[model samples]
Target: MLVEFTALHWIYVVFIVLIIGFMVKRWDTSLISILGIFVLAIVATGDLTAALSKVFNSFIYAITELLSTILIISLIVAMSQVMKKSGINEVMVAPFTKLIRTPTLAYWVTGILMMIISWFFWPSPAVALLGAVLLPVAIRAGLPALGVAMAMNLFGHGIALSGDFIIQGAPKLTADAAGIPVADVVSASVPLVIVMGVVTTITAFIFLRRDMKKGTLELVGTYDGEKVEEKSENLLTLGQKKFFALLIVVAFLLDVLAMSLLKLTGGDATALVGGTAVFILLLLAVVAHKKKGLEKTTSYFIEGFQFGFKVFGPVIPIAAFFYLGDSGFIKIIGEYLPSTSQGIVNDLGLGLAALVPLTKEIAVVTLAGVGAITGLDGSGFSGITLAGSIANLFGTAIGEGTATLTALGQIAAIWVGGGTLVPWALIPAAAICNVSPFELARRNLVPVVVGLVVTTIVAMFLI
Candidate 1:
């Protein structure tokens, strides 16, 4: 076996299956996640004390990795609370109401806007930019909070991110590893991206509409399982509301412009949006609560932080367990993985690639499977290199379609891990809409799986 396939690797694989089982059954995976970490530590180190401590250490690693996302959600929620109370959210969404009058329109409009902005700025910052503005409008138009979350997730993270046409970040990683041109990967990915995007979005929409008509889905709009209480009386006058609303719009627009001109993406772009939100929150807090401004600002932050941590509590353990599959093993546990091992996840991907025969049908299937396995770490980008390497091996043997195979792998990795099906990965959309991340993941499960299956079959012909 490659990389000395040991008990530790088997342990990790077993727990992954168990965790997935828990998630599919709608059971809490926190216990299983923590148990997995402890067992892995014990098997790796043979120290009970160390095993116990690794559990705590893994959570620290998960939170450290997740803190930026937490902060962004906290800031956005704080700003949203103030805006909602001052009634500026109403004014901000008024123009959108004209364009999105029904649930179907709300789903498509929000999804399309999310896709366009995500292509430019990427999904994290795009979620921050769009969620506060469009979520309210969508809800008012009869789309459930979960439905709005689905739209943002599928279009932004699944479509825009998988194709990554403008940023070209995804294709660059895969193409380099596969020894192909970046343009080839991008060009090849277009049809696969379209197929996945269309299938997932339409399936999600149809399910959402069906649930709504059946009255099986809850209609309440919440941000952390709590209903937003609208202010009985508007603190801002008509003119004030309009002025503040436009000011917010202009401020975010300027941020978007700055993102393009300064070439800020990912963390830098997210920081810009976060800073803008803090300022907006302060302005609204002071205006709405005047003499009580200072106290009110503190209270709003408390509210936001409370929601952030509350939402993340269940996620930390599962994220920690997944992290161990990557570089996190060295950090959270120890450097016990053999020197030749390319981390557990990557090694497993390579192992699977080694086992599969190099025919186009098996090549495409194995690439998708390998991509998905690597993506279990939840950083979709972390594993595309492995996907690309496998694509190269299969392509070399098959004597053709390297780019198409690589593109298919990239699509599968991203759609599974970038944010659609993974609970923690897609939490931004879930947090912004105030829906449960796990529930959002569940809602996304069928659509994403169907899309991946259909896209995989389509790639057979493309190859």
Candidate 2:
């Protein structure tokens, strides 16, 4: 079937072109692109009277709908920040240093830590903590900073963030788009995640081993060759340290209890995590700076919000563009299509499906490859909605494991875009480690690509 373009469709195309061009040229802010799209949509529909209303209405709606997930992310980030200032971040990774005495162990430990914390917190915050604490240890153990970053990126942002099992952020988005239950997506993703994780980590290890043999390791320290200052220790008082430790333990225990007792799933679980973070933040601010009064308390929260926005702001417009592909948000454009109409990305996928005479094996590989290529634009999660919809369309025609195949696509997309192929996403980690982002991307290319290929093959057979 030929896809017809209405005025709204033309507006979307124009918006995408403008956004992509701006991103490629590094000429426009994400906020500008997002507002541009909204404005264009309103103008296309010739609804100036409603345009003003939509400015506030659309943002409010989106924010409200995503409030639970965003709050959870913000709280987790704030908690990690608190831990960093209190020295718990150092303490948390201190024991791991002993265990990761060798380059091989360093790679595994970095990957594992990134995965665990990224699952609960996020890769952005996890990168800061991991780079501050674990990077030095890994580098001193003869691991390259490049290798350390690769491990963190592939495991934390690529695999863990893509799966988002603990927080359910990525899976929730994919599930919502596919009109599938979040539990179903999460369950189906387990095997796919295992395949990708094993393949990616092993490939990264191979690269690390090769680098180690070459004796190209660089350690993180001051100019005089001493370990970096123990910034964390000097930042907190003794009482503050004790209080944060107790608070962390209580927060974690409460999380476990909430998950167990309430049987919270998806957004509910995310809200529980966020709520706990807020409670801890409040407690810490009160106990630590009680003498400063309410002004200090407000300042801490403002700091938290600033941190959250800094990390997550760039993602909003990117996400908004992808949201255009979702059925729920399409109505906002005010152009109704037939019930049989497919979103633009879905239409593109179906077109590919038609042209490619793919067997089950070929289908899985093709899907993975396509997803990875799409992710090259530098937003990992951006491709999932497209990939998920396509996977459902194509996988259903082939056999019984559609969800698993869909998940394979999701993994490839995230592993590539999350940080491995893109310098933009690697900025935080690279800056913290004092490494070159472009070089980090170069080092990640081979291992991550090889891993995605192997994982796709494994998933083809298993799924």
Q: After superposition, how far is residue 420 of candidate 2 from its true place, in Å?
A: 2.7
lDDT of 1: 0.79
TM-score for candidate 2, residues paired by index: 0.79
Q: Against the unseen true structure, what C-alpha lDDT does each candidate score?
A: 0.79, 0.68
Off by over 4 Å in 2: 1-60, 219-230, 233-243, 246-250, 260-262, 293-296, 311-314, 321-326, 329-331, 339-363, 392-402, 461-463
lDDT of 2 at 120: 69
Error of 1 at 409 (Å): 9.9
The positional error of residue 300 in candidate 2, measured at the CA in angstroms, is 3.6
RMSD (Cα, Å) of candidate 1? 7.4
The number of clashing residue pairs in each candidate reads 1, 0
Winning candidate number (lDDT): 1
